[model samples]
Target: MANRLKRTSEGFISYRFAAIVIAALFFASLAGWIAQELVPPDFVERKAFYGESWRPGLARAVDLLRLHDPFHSLWYRFVLAFFFAVLVACNVSRFRRIALRSLRAELPAGAEELRKRPLSFDLSWRSLAAGPRGDADPLVRYGELHGRREAVDPAALEGFFARVSALLKRRGLRVVSDRADGVIRFTASSGRLRSPGTMLLHAGIVVITIGGLIGSLFGWRGMVYLKAGETAPLPPDSAAVLRVDEFRIVTGHGGAIRSYVSTVTILGTRGETLAAGSIEVNRPLGYKGVNIHQSSYTMGEGEFARASVSYRLRGETGRRTVELRGTASAVLGDGAAVVTALRFLPDFRMGPEGAFSASPFPANPALEVEVSAAGGAQRGWLFLRHPDFNARFAAGIDLALDGVEPVYYTGLELSSNPGAPVLMAGFAAATIGLIFMYFCNPRVIRGIATREGLIAAGVESRWKASFELEFAGIREAIRREFDESG
Candidate 1:
């Protein structure tokens, strides 16, 4: 009675309300996560800080809604927490009833109930009476007792019951028997472990939810760029430091970068080594709860030890290379002309304000050169791509620009999340549960023996087709035994 009441309550919670709530929470969380991605935290902060007049009101609304960081938002977290509770409650209620019923040692239904089962059949001694000649045939019973075979011969009943019991065991059924008042009952079951499979599955979902919560609340991700041999402290408030031992880039046949490799060292605040390893694209290094990945690189202005430019006169036989540095003057080979290196830009760009480098990549190298000779001092832009900036110097000499050397810096992306292990365990548990639920189907069979004959059958498993085939084979074996006994 207690189990029945538990089932009734479980059905009410599971079907009437639990599923809908969980589904709603799941879709809500999903939508919030997508919205968070659309409104990036960095972009929102940039717009808000600059007070950009063109900013979309929707972006501000998203920030106000905390959709910029949805997973960590109060409402989303509450949804996860509530869904977790629902799963636990549903699992506990359903597991108790299913476990008790599946592990039952006795058959709960009577012969009439068994006859009404979907995958059940009957075997009657009256059928044996209708032989080839329609003659009264000798009856048989599989029995370990004599009292129940009052109308039929005891020996015949014993033989039939014995054969059937052995057959049930051979079919991998764990059998239990009871006898009283000239009647015998037998119950058998298969794949008993399946009862707990679904419970474990639910537990897995709860674990995964907890993991996600942990990650949302505590995990962090950031990028750090460092030059080779440079040691930099980790994020503010972190007691660790990262040292770049080396950085390398491998190029493929087409000069495309095939991989980015960084040999990095992790150290304590006191400069003691904690860990050292190499990281490549897709291959991250883990130390002290943090993962470092090779993300990108840059070449910034003034990163080079020296800057230089080469030039050739309009009718000169060879090009002259003159090394350049900050505010340096170099006299031309010709006594009539002079060149002054006023400024250098690794990646040159011109703006209304002034000259500057657009980025670290030295795509268009440039030098600000001032030439003074017998005529007067003239300033011009000498570009590596367009070298003929001041071709018509006062001294009738032309100058062509050359390349500028660059220094590179490596970018490493670091992330830390405390919930990874819990998430992994949850996924494993869920997979095991599914395997048990689908492959380890539970099957139960029951039988009653009388002086007249024996009636035995069972229900098909969830895999209905396979269960039907196995049941058919069991029936065939029973027929063979009956025919042979006759």
Candidate 2:
């Protein structure tokens, strides 16, 4: 039973299993994003978009697989959990290997073992004395005496090993030497933290996965539509109310819309305002851990639309402002004339029979009004953009359309995620780990120095070409040191 358990655990933590889990996560996330885009948020709209051909089959598939909201689905969460487990197991296994390699202090068994390494060389004193011969490098191989064991004086061997150890120490490598059976074995290493740095990177990935799971399980996302001067209850079980005080559309040159802003207020249960602020694209308003983002807007006639009209009587020196909504009447100049708003047209147009609106968008807004006085009544249009046209209807009173209240519903997306900070911390940790792993090149050099000459080998974690040059430089330095001493 213990052996079976061991086999299962080993398989679960294997690199092949980790790769399969990673692939599953990537494809799952991709499919989720595609489904989110193809399916509408509203159920009716999603059904309509699916059309008649996909009525039962595709619809059932989408619902059964939870494609519309895959991130929150049970199967996706299970996959994420599996992926996290794989990462944790793999990190543990890797850390064990790194610890073993870091703690081990044994040198290569013999010259043959050293020669099998990626970088290795054998040198003898006879060839060094002969000097460079026919392009044969003494630092790499001792010319014709390469790999040949030759006698060396004990005192000379001791001096040579001492100089090499000092050189390794000067180059920031930790050196350890052992003497057994007249053979001097030494090992030197630098940048021992490289493996731990790689382990840190994997641990950071595991942390990121944990954070994502927390967000998926506990977080909430919803949307709400609120018109100007309107209030609605917040979604996802919040008792707070979200109110839109005003909405403004900023236009740039050529009358193109630059941005839209919503002045919003969050009200407590007692109708007390908790927070008030403006929200624009990419900017969100936060209240009680809920973030409200301005997602979109729709234009149409609003139930509470109001028109601001300014009027002056024939004998009055100043004008008075009055608000009108949907055929509401207001007195002008102490009841000298009763002004009634008959119709309002946003993006006005003069039809053959009457005045009408070209579009719901407020461009060239105009208001039609009826003025009643002792001399009878007159009806005319007051243009908000072109106030000069008001003079045509100045029979008893001069009137101008100052402005009109916006009739737009601001769409706000509300979300709350407690794991965002954790995710950010994970990313920062991963970045630091990557920097350490790439820049801190770990290297190890082992050598056996004896009366029969020297055998050396080296290995580096990465950047083999650069390490080769560095190793060659070290060999040359050793050779130079010996020649100078002689």
TM match of model 2 to true structure: 0.68
Q: What TM-score fits each model? A: 0.72, 0.68
Whole-model alpha-carbon lDDT for candidate 1: 0.73
Model 2, 31-121: lDDT tens per residue?
8889889866764456655745576677767777777778888888888778888898898888888777767766768777887887987
Kindly provide the TM-score of model 1 when superposed on the true structure, using C-alpha atoms.
0.72
Cα lDDT tens digits, model 1, 1-486, are 999998876665675567777787879888886886777567655866534553567657666667777876777868767777777778776877878866677663567877777777666544433333212333333321232332466666666678788988998988788776566678877887676677778888888988987887899889888888887777646788899988887899899978988999888978899899999988999876788889898865644535566666657878787776556677777656678766667778879999898877767777777888878898877777766443456666667665565556889998888999999999999889878877786777788876666667775367678888888788767766566334
Clashing pairs in 2: none
* Candidate 1 residue 474 C-alpha distance from true site, Å: 3.8
Question: lDDT per prediction?
Answer: 0.73, 0.79
